[model samples]
Target: MNMVQLERMKNDKGFIAALDQSGGSTPKALGLYGIAKETYTDESEMIQLMHEMRSRIMESPAFTKERILAAILFEKTMDLKVAGKYSADYLWENKGILSILKVDKGLLDLQDGVQLMKPIPKLDELLVRAKDRHIFGTKMRSVIKEANEVGIKAIVDQQFEIGAVISAAGFIPILEPEVDIHTPNKEVAEAILKKELIEHLKNLDPTYQVMLKVTIPDIDNFYEELMNYPNVVRVVALSGGYPREEANEKLKKNHNLIASFSRALTEGLNVNQSDEAFNHMLDQSIQSIYEASI
Candidate 1:
């Protein structure tokens, strides 16, 4: 929390030496634009940088959330119990995230495509504690149904869909800027690079539209293949080294890493959880998109 201490240690290359020291968290898209003034707009290079950081994370034994917080947060030997339920009466706090809760009544695609949504914190086991704050889900269903009313088709995370036939899914294909692809040894992938992973992941997504994280060498080697995906929308920092839509200018200044809003807009609506405001926003964005689209 102390900027002074952080600044002091930042000079010690050895401190962060264990991780992807090659690329610092990265200047945000806006910040990059501000600094580069030019040349930073090259997305190919930024893609490589993302893989570099991912490799570092995968290679480090110390950074894993399990290992890093093992001492207390989820101590291997301690009780993992927290108790409360929504069976009792509940009241609205009105206090919520997002200054304005925008409603997106976007037209949904009833076409049975694998509409990939963002992963929710609901890990299938624990009941979300923030049930009182559930608002997004109600909105999403309405949108999906609305999409159905139109002739547009859609589906959720399907195996395959082709051409404009894939257009009606009520979801936009989002991009994942980076992914952790450790080798069989669970270390940084050396013999195999980003390409192999991309090649391999290319098949994993039933929808065929996915954000891939592969090594740089892989991208370099399989440049043709990566560039050739029919529906892939490569992850680009919406505000980073280049303009999201333009892709021809420097990122804005002094910013560090941030999620791509365009990607998140679609990823966010996939689920609803009691505590996450982003999830609700995604949901509403989906609706808003549909409403506006229709």
Candidate 2:
């Protein structure tokens, strides 16, 4: 599929599910789920788990084509075909789930209340591959833990620069500058993030349109200012470290935002559970998260 088809997919489906976990974060997720580190050492083992998870999701009626508009995927899982027939993208698209690629390499060392993603070399090559694979969009992330103007400016500049490149290539870009939920001054940091984001976006070429995945703000309707921007397609919230229930509570306050949560969305699912048990859990998760989105 080309960019035009991808845009159609986005328009036809409104919600997105983020399943992208890079190498650095995968270990943390495994540990959280009590999966032994050795299980992920063999690349095949991890791939198998991802495949099964996707299978279960597609099997569930609750996670129908209309419910999950798209799924954000890690690089390794991008080309994987489910049931040895449909590519991950095709499999989901059959059910109305557009595919989105996670493009950032990973994060760098924490510096003064912020951390930037490591630079990706030959990013054009990756974008080409994403296009060939029929992915509808791409996402990259950086973290802001405090209200430092210098750090925030740098983060905003880099995201818009990358986002511009992505938009030019015909993929909608999800620019995620996640503020840490644990920050002592989360409200302050979010206020600054919104301001910096708006300023940079206003200066961007009118052709570039992007989505935002930010932390659920500390204050209600804090992101209203951002949603008003013409270039922003939508605003989605990350779970940060919050549990599912708490995350849902906060999400309900903001009528404009929806969820792209990872851990919180999968909090109760276990890889080792029986088929019935697994699907039951996934059903609950989909129900809760879907309700919160609306």
Q: Model 1: what TM-score?
A: 0.22
- Candidate 1 stretches with Cα past 4 Å from truth are 1-120, 123-193, 201-206, 213-224, 235-294
Candidate that scores best on TM-score: 2
Q: Determine which window of 10 residues in candidate 1 has minimal summed lDDT.
A: 69-78
How do all models score by TM-score?
0.22, 0.91
Each candidate: what lDDT? 0.24, 0.77
lDDT (10s digit) by residue, model 2, range 1-294: 255445544354345677887676776666655576777667678666665665565656666655566778888777777656445556455665677799999878887678888898988999998877877789999999777777877888888888888899988899999998777788888888888888887787777888898999988878877877778777888888889899888988987688888888667777677778877887788778877877
**lDDT tens readout by residue for model 1, 237-287:** 222122222211121221221122222222222212232553344345433
What is residue 243's positional error in candidate 2, in angstroms? 0.5
